[model samples]
Target: MARNSADRLLRQFLLKAIGPIRRLGIPIPAKISKHLQFRGVVDVSVGSGASFKMQSHGHAIENRMYWYGKRGHEPETFLPWLEASKTAEVVLDIGANTGLYSLGAAATNRTSRVLAFEPVPRVAELTRHNARLNPSSNIEVFELAVSDENGTAILHDPGGDQPASASLRGDFLDCKQTEIKVRCVRIDDFLSEVNLSRVDLIKLDVEGIEELALRGMRTTLQTHMPTLFIEVLDARPELMAELNGLLNMGYQVGDLCSDGVIPYDLSDKKGVERNLLFAKDLSRFQ
Candidate 1:
């Protein structure tokens, strides 16, 4: 049964109402959250004719559920993705936590092939479980981290229930509860190893290690020139270098907003902490 807007609103209100109580380790909010799911996962209907299967207990699942019920989440990001994938044959989603963009893309375009890469094994399995829920969607889930080089890295997982803040940054991971060694591969190397074709669109959100991931894909960026939708979190040293590297490599970077994609000025200290789009062709977005 579809949750009407009223039902969704009521659930959120209840969650908020018991938040303080729940924070005191009361477990009331958790019980309420558990009841919200019709099954083990909540179904969210994303635009372009697709629904996402989300873990009932995952991080930010509430807001994401609201968005799915409404048919889109982040319009600024989703709008461009929807547009780019119309003609895209291959799409890469890195750091695809529970496969939001990955599932969203696959749902939006049935003909497009979406590869979701998540280093966290547990999270990756969740992505797979969600993909299976959308049986008709052509989404592939991978459990390897992408970096500038091929090797293993210590991935910090903030627990399965709270995966939004997980990353490979040692400092960032240090604050988290668990650390696990994970195998990583560069986009270039992975493509060759798997014999995958050129990717037309890439959505990257690997925390502060965006530069390292980009470095590993220098060849792909130069040769394929895929459209990029990436998020830059905080003021990491790699952020500037990654932005500069994109500019040097003939890509125009912009910020996605409710209105749409706006020209990005990386030097602006205020805008460094937002989602960015890097593209060689801006016609689709325009």
Candidate 2:
């Protein structure tokens, strides 16, 4: 696997170069990342005995290849969840997009239920396809966006880099592009409909509209208070509401990096590094 995906200088360089652009609200990186081919359907090992099937032209494939070439991706977030997944009842992936975190959870523990939500029709299909590749894993792919409302909304497609980076929030992508209407639902409402009693872990990465999505999941957040791996793009006042809300729900938040999940401050955003892990009991995370 490493021989096929390792040291593709151009591909890795492109992904690295576009990192800043992506953080600046540009979608060009996502577009290029999707079309640039490093290899075809290479396997990615995410550590802790977990692996995933990734693609050459898929969204974030270059990054996945880098992990294959080096070590696993986001050990600060991935490793801890993997340790806990064996006993977790349910793992929710909001914006799964080809099953990065979702596939990792399922691969780590076949008994745990990994529910992946990707609103883009094609991306959702791709996620399901990835899940199928891991026959022993237990994962369910849903083709709907989770927001603060139950209805339909315009999902702006990046049109090249990948469908995984598509967004429901307007002006998400700096450049002009096309869009498709997608069904949206709040997690709280869907949980009730499905009668899910508990959710052990959640990975939320929906561009920058995460605050709105959390608003709709207030009940679920209060009930489960599941450990959350969320990415916040900006430190804007609006986005802070979401983090503050979690605090009000008796949860603590921190940045998830290679070292660990450390105390996170909104003013300390370094770049596109926005993944924050929230927990009611920090000791569980430690």
Candidate 3:
């Protein structure tokens, strides 16, 4: 009874907060708004205050919705690599949010297979939904968080349309306070279990847990030497270590923007931290 009451209270608070944003009719990019509309996910209003109805995917698809609209577009930095790779047979999307990379890769013909991993249940659900909507025969969705160890952990619900880092405190504004036993697996174990010989590309954007995931994939790194496109945020020291670890492994790195690749070295760890890239071999691109 108490749990039900708490849930109701949380719902009310979230609705109250979301209602204002919904009414404001924020301006979203055309492509993003269109995608959302086609999927019947977003009900947006343009400059004229006219109500625009997005195509409904069906009875209000949940867990597969993309929050923040076009902001969810593939980070400009990774586009070139994504386009340049013609022989990429296997793609691994770590922290595959709402199937952006997952759906995009599945849409492309070059990518023969894709494995999307999202630990957050809500986001994972959306990933699965988008994958199904797109219907990629080769895409596989895994609803588990990847780390160095294999076990269950607490997934904090910072409730919104999308899932954020699982927090330790139960203080999300509109999020229901609940504990989900999410699976934690390493890349080596994952590869062994699935018997994957090679991975062409690995794109990771797992909040602040990238290091742990990388640590778990040391074996995969040594074996496949797949090109990695990681979203390296500058806020965490642990993340910095992960990037350094990759560099230590002798991978050449660069930034992927809409224009082209900008090669860089992370030898200096003291500048105003920016999103950078690393590659195992620059000659491959040349």
Tens digits of per-residue lDDT for model 2, 1-286: 6764654666668656765664464445334555454445656665665676755453354454533321335566666666656667799999887776787788777778889999888778778877887788888999888899999999988876355568887788787767899999999999888888888888888987888888888888898888888877777677786788888888877777777767765555462446787887666666
Q: Once superposed on the true structure, which residue ranges of model 3 sit more than 4 Å away at CA?
A: 1-72, 164-179, 257-259, 267-275, 282-286
Candidate 1 lDDT trough over 10 residues, lowest sum: 63-72
Clashing residue pairs in all predictions, respectively, total 0, 4, 17
Q: List, residue by residue over 19-90, the lDDT tens digit for candidate 1.
A: 566446443333355544322466666555566566555345544453234233566787677677777789
Model 1 collision count: 0
lDDT of 2: 0.74
Indicate whether candidate 1 or candidate 2 has the larger lDDT.
Answer: 1
Candidate 1 has an lDDT of 0.76
Q: What TM-score would each prediction reach against the true structure?
A: 0.80, 0.79, 0.68
lDDT of 3 at 213: 87
Give per-residue CA lDDT, model 3, range 149-244, as digits (tens): 888776666666665455322442345656777888888899888888888778877665667888999888877788887766554677667777
Model 1: how far residue 240 lies from native, Å: 1.6
Error of 2 at 178 (Å): 0.9
Ranking by TM-score: 1, 2, 3
Candidate 3 has a TM-score of: 0.68
lDDT score at residue 92, model 1, on the 0-100 scale: 96
